[model samples]
Structure formats: C-alpha cells, structure tokens
Target: MVKFRNAAAAFKALNGLICVYKPACVPIQQIQHTILTNLCRDLNVLPDRPHEKRVEIVGPTNAPMTVKLVPNYADNPLVCGPRYIKEDFRCSWATHLGLFTSGVLLLGINQGTKLTYLINTARLTRAYKIHGQLGKATDTYFWNGKTVEKSTYGHVTREKIDKVVAHMQAAHQKTMFEMSGVHMESQTMFDLAAQGLIRPANNNLPVIYGIKCVYFNSPNITLEIQAINEYDKYLWTIIHDLGVQLKTSAHCTGVQCIRQGKFDLDIALLRKHWQLEYIIDNMDQCRRLMEEHSLILQPKSAILSV
Candidate 1:
C-alpha cells in the first residue's frame, strides 16, 4: 500500500480510476457527491494542514513599526471552513448506471477524467448478472415500475429458458456483424470474428457479445451477459423479451454490473471504504490493472479481447 505524508500528497495522488459498488435505488450523482464529500472530510482531518499566514501590524494608529507574519487561527480551516470541498475534485464516471441498477461503477478523478473518454470510445465490454422474475410484466420492464400485466410461469421450464437464451444470443451475434459496419461477404469479417468478439464501429449502438442463462428456478432466473454500449433500459428489455419468447411475462428484479472491461467487483470499494486512504489505494490498484492490461488504455484492435 502506498502512504502519503500529508493530505495534500494524498489528494494529489488521486489521479486515476477508482471502482465502487453502487447500491440500488441511488442516483449516480448522489454517489459522486458522497464520495467527494467523504474525501474532503477525511483529507481535512489529516495532519500537517497549516493555518493561513497573515501579516500582523505592530504599530496600530500612528505608524507600522514592524510587521510580523503569524499563523492566523481565525482563517484556519476549522474556524472559517474546510480547505477542501466536494467541488474541488474533478470526478467523472466512465459509464452511467441506471438509478435502479447497481454494482461496479468506475470513476475517474482529476487527471484520470481524461481516461474515461478513452474507455468510452474504446467500446470495452461490460458483464452483468441480471436477475428476473417470471409471471410479472411492468411498464418499465423492471420490478419497480407499475405492473402492467402478469401471466402464469408454471409452463416455463429450465430447458425452455435456455433455448430462448440461446436463440437471443444467436440473433444478437448476427446483428453484431451488421452493426459492426463490416462487409458481410468480405474476408475481413471472418478474420475479425476469428480473432475475438468484434466491437461495433459505432459506439452509440449497443451490442451484446455474449448472453447465457446462468441460474434458473421456477419463478426466478439469472442471466450472465457481456455487452458493450448498453443502457439499463436495454438490459431490462432483454428480460421482457425473454418472457415474450417463453410465452410468459417477466420483469427484471435486479441488474448488477459484475465487471467493466478490466475492472471487476472484487476490487471495487464498498460504501464503508469510500474514504481517502481506500481511494488512494484503489487508484494505485487501478493503475496496476491498467499496466497489466495495456489494451485497456490503448486498444490496438477493435477486437474485444479483454
């Protein structure tokens, strides 16, 4: 673990990506504010934060004989205000997780803010473990939304669900090539697919590289999906579509992003660890992760290997 002599040193060291596990029902902006507020509070309490220096006039009315520079306790952070505020830090997220979605969220601080753009443009794949409930359909395709319809899920078997998932995956795979902006008949398409998952040239288009049903019980089902440029609604709609394919109704119970590119939930900071020390350590770990996977920083090919 890297140590800092002072708060300033620690603050300065916060110049890379940090992963946090965002809880459900909380807005991303609130999470950002909380993290920044914690950082400011923790940093201000650290040692070596000197009071502001002020020049004290020796002679008052007539003439100033000697002017002595003294530490101004009145202007000290404790007296006036905190030296740092949430606004002092430049923090940005690489991806926008929905208000209802939760899990690994990557944030870039200060100099690392530039890297967020790179990550976005790189079109890195994100893995999600989505939970769905059978016999329910909502207006928004999620559990929180208004229930629009419901149906019997007794006929929905594991084999039926797996078949639907396989069909969905195959359909998305075919669409991936079309959206990739490559000639279907050309050899380039084969070469790219042969290498690995071909990233869509258009970053705005959501592409699902892989999708499979990981867990399945009568009324509950879980899917493991790897996709890029996806939105929360898109993922939720997948559950809705799955229900339709199976001749039943379903709504997404939860959406958890397990991984994004090289960053995974294992290294993500929980709410309790969103302090200065943990943030600095997380930044260091992120730097190491990037070093180990240089392709994350600079992609040599559009193939999504990572």
Candidate 2:
C-alpha cells in the first residue's frame, strides 16, 4: 500500500517530495491518484467557487449558470441548503514499475514536481532482487509470457548458474550486444532457442552494472541485479542469453537506492523530516529545517529555478 504523510505545510514552505514503496500488483498511476485524492480530502479542498451560488451571465450566455456546491460541513445539503468554509490550502514518482513488479518509486509533489526532469536525468542507480524459475523459455522472452520452449534441466547445476552470473557481471562493454524487442531495437535474441544465433547488431553497451546469482535451489533461482537502466526486460534478456531457461516470470522482491548521491533515494532519512508543523507556513523555518536535515537533497531548489 502507498502511504501518504502530511507534507502540505512543509511543501509550501520548503519543497515537496515523496518516497513511495509501491507493492506488486499496483500500478504507479494508481498510487499517484491515491496520494492526490487523500491529500485533497485531508486538506478540505473544495470546488473552485465555494461562496458563489451561480456564475454571472457572460456574453454568450442568456441565463446565469447555476453552480453545484457540496458543502463539506453540511449534513443534509438538500434540506439545510449549502454551507461554505474559508479554510484555504492546496497541495499536489516517475520511475515506473510494472503491475507485477514492486520497488521504490520516487515522486515529486507540489513544488517538488518541478524536479522531475532533473531527477530523471540524475543517473540514479537501482538494485533489485528478482526471483524466477529455471528450465523453460517463454514466448515473450520472459517467464510471465506464454511458454514457448521447454527443456530438461537434469544436467543443470548450481555451478553452471554461478558461471553464467559471473559471465554477465564480467562482460565488457564490447561483448554485450543489445537484444531488440527486449526494450530497444528490433533484432531478436533467441529466434530458434539458440544462444549463438542471438547476435543483435546493436553496438551500444548495456547499462547493467553487475548481476549475481544469490541463491539457486532446484527450479527457483534468486538474482541480485544492479543496473542503471529503467527497463527490467534488459535483465531478462541478459539472463536468457546466459543460458538460464526461465520457467517462471521474474518478480522484483526487493529494491534499494544504494549509490550515495543527490538523487539517491533514502526514504528513512526523509521520513524524520516530514514534520509538517515545524515548517508550517514559514519559509524561513522551512529553510532552517532543511539545513538541519541536509540529507534532503537540494534538487527541489533546482526545480524552483525552472
């Protein structure tokens, strides 16, 4: 479940940014919608016009346009008429995860929304723990896809899997050929289920940092992968090319932003500073709080400049 902390005052004073832990089976857009809806409801945000019952006639209109207002404090709007309040406050993750995948999703809220471009290009590295089965190939080049090839793994051993991981981790920039349809380009990686035939002419290097087979017990294998790219398909393609027959589709079990930098997401550190009351309606106080919690990156400042 996506959790939302009240950062309205802090956001207005300092900058708005949020760290969301998106679980599997939930869309990123859905998480965004939930946050927006919850924040709106909590802040008592009303329609644009709360006081006016109707809009005055304009040049094209012959009669006044009646406005429908649902009073937040009204118990029976139809019987008691409309009621209005004067409280005014307003507040508003781009690293997309698949519906079946779960991981850390960074979001920029309110003024923080302006930092999307900078954060997206900040070269943040991500770590993922993926689980999948071995000994079969799916038609879609991933275990989640329909089964296309099946083979006996009686001869496959843990040693073989380790070698494959080492091969992938030690692979040089020149040896790694990008597979088409696995995210980019159009060359096929495994047309006839042969690894030798997968020679995609793409000359670009893979953005993968390293891959390690964490555990290999029979049909299930856990892989700890570190990559700079956004697409998880590339990891699947690399695993396939390394000769691991994927029986089950891979699911990211754990994700962490490891690199210590401006864009690295360390939510635990940020949560402590989410004290909205401390920075409530005070820009100077917010700046002081920000300085005190210097771990909160200054990307929000860069966003404000834009």
Candidate 3:
C-alpha cells in the first residue's frame, strides 16, 4: 500500500483505478460528483495544507519602506477557498449503469482515465444477478414501472426456466459468430467456437456469454448472467423476453452487477467510504489486480482470459 505524508502527496498519488458500489435509483453523475467532492473536502482538511502567502509593506511613511512575505491567515483556505475542488480531478467510469441498476462500478482517476480506453477495448465480460418478477409486465420493463399487463405464473417451473436460458445462450453464441463477420461454414468460425465463448469484435454489440437461474420461487426468479457490452435496459429486456418465452409476462425487479472483468463486489467501496484514504486504497487494489491479470489490458483476443 502507498502511504502519503500529507494531502498534497495523497492528491498527487490519486491517479489510478478505483471500484465503488453504486446504490440503486441514483444517477451515475451524482456518484461521480459526490466522490470528487469528498476527495477535495478530505484533502483540504488534512494537516500540512499551506496557507496563502501575501507580500505586505513592513515599514510605512517613516524610513525606507521594506516589503516582507508572510503566510496570511485571512487568505487561508478557511477564509479564501479550498486547495482542491471537484474540477481539479478527472474521473471517468469504464461501464455505465442505469439509474435503477446498482453494482460494481469501475472508475479511473487522473492518469488512470487513459486506462479506461484499454478496458473498453478489451471488451471484458460483466456478470449481473438480476431479480425478476413473473406474471407481470411493465411499460419500462422494470417492476417499478407502470404495469401494462398481468398473467398467471403457476405454469412456470425451474426446469423450464433453465431450458429457456440454455436456448438463449446457444442463440447468442451462434450470433456471436454471425456478428464476427466470419463465414458460417468456415474453419475459422468453428475454431473460434471450439475455444469457448467468443466476445463480439464490435464493442457496441451486446452478447450474453452465459446465463443461469440461480434462485426461483413463485412469482420471483433470480438470474445470474454474464454478458458483454450490455446496459441496464438490455438486462431488463431479457427478463421481459424470458417471460414471453415461458408463456407468461415478467418484469425486472432489480439489477445488480456482481462483477466486471476481475473487479468484483468485494472490492467495491460503498458510498459512505468514498473518502480520500479509502479511494487511495481502492486504487492500489485495482492496480494490483490489473498487474496480476495482464490480459485485462490486452485487446487482441475476443475470448476473455479466465
């Protein structure tokens, strides 16, 4: 772990990746602003912050005027302004989560922002544990959205859910090759499929690497999905489509990203811990994880390294 003598040192060392847990129903921009604000606040209050210096005339009207420079309490941060502000730091997020979706969010700070491009280019797969409701459909595909349709869920079973999930995974895997711009009967396509789940070369295309029903009960079902280039609405739509596939209607109740690349929820800091010390620690942890898993920076292969 890196140690700092003062806030100035800490601020300078703050150029790296950090993971944070974003709560549901909160805007991503708000989280970014809050984190940056907290960083500035903590750094400004730390010890060894230099006061603004002012040059004052020492002797007046009597002898030769002498000028001296001294620390001015009036110009101190408490009176003038904080040494750091939200604008001073540049924070960029690798993945974008929707307002209703919460999970592990990866952010790059200062020089770390450049790493985000590599991460995006790598097309890392993300895992989401989505909670969904059966027998109901919403306009926005979320449980909170206005209900548009309702039906009975008694016919749904765990076995049937698994079948549908398997079929969906297979269909997506086939689509992966189709979208890869490779000929369907070519050996290259077969070789790629034999290797395992192949990510789409185009970053804009959404592909589901894997999906399974982790938990199930009447009216409620939980699905754990590993996907690439996906957004909140896309996950919600999966639930809506699953309902259609099961001869019923369903809506998403919640969406939580469990993992992104090697970064997992365990490493994500909560809102309350967004302080300077915690952020620095999180950054170090992320750096080590990346170093250990160098494939995260490699963009050549469509197959992600386990």
Extract clashing residue pairs from model 1.
none
Score candidate 3 by lDDT: 0.87
Rank order (by TM-score, best first): 1, 3, 2
lDDT of 2: 0.48
Deviation from truth (RMSD, Å), model 3: 3.1
**How many residue pairs clash in model 1?**
0
Candidate 3's C-alpha runs over 4 A off are: 1-3, 52-70, 181-185, 194-197, 303-306
Worst 10 contiguous positions by lDDT, candidate 1: 297-306
Candidate 2 structure quality by residue, lDDT tens digits, 26-100: 776676666554544434332322333433333435666555544444444455543322122222253555676
Please report how far candidate 2 places residue 152 from its true position, in Å. Answer: 1.6
For candidate 1, give the lDDT: 0.87
lDDT of 3 at 27: 91
Off by over 4 Å in 2: 1-14, 45-92, 172-205, 244-306
How well does candidate 1 match the true structure, expressed as C-alpha RMSD? 3.1
Residues 182-236, model 3: lDDT tens digits: 7889998788777766765556678887899999997899999999889888999
Please provide TM-scores, in order, for all candidate models, with all chains considered together. Answer: 0.90, 0.56, 0.90
Cα lDDT tens digits, model 1, 87-128, are: 789989998999988999989999989888788667678999
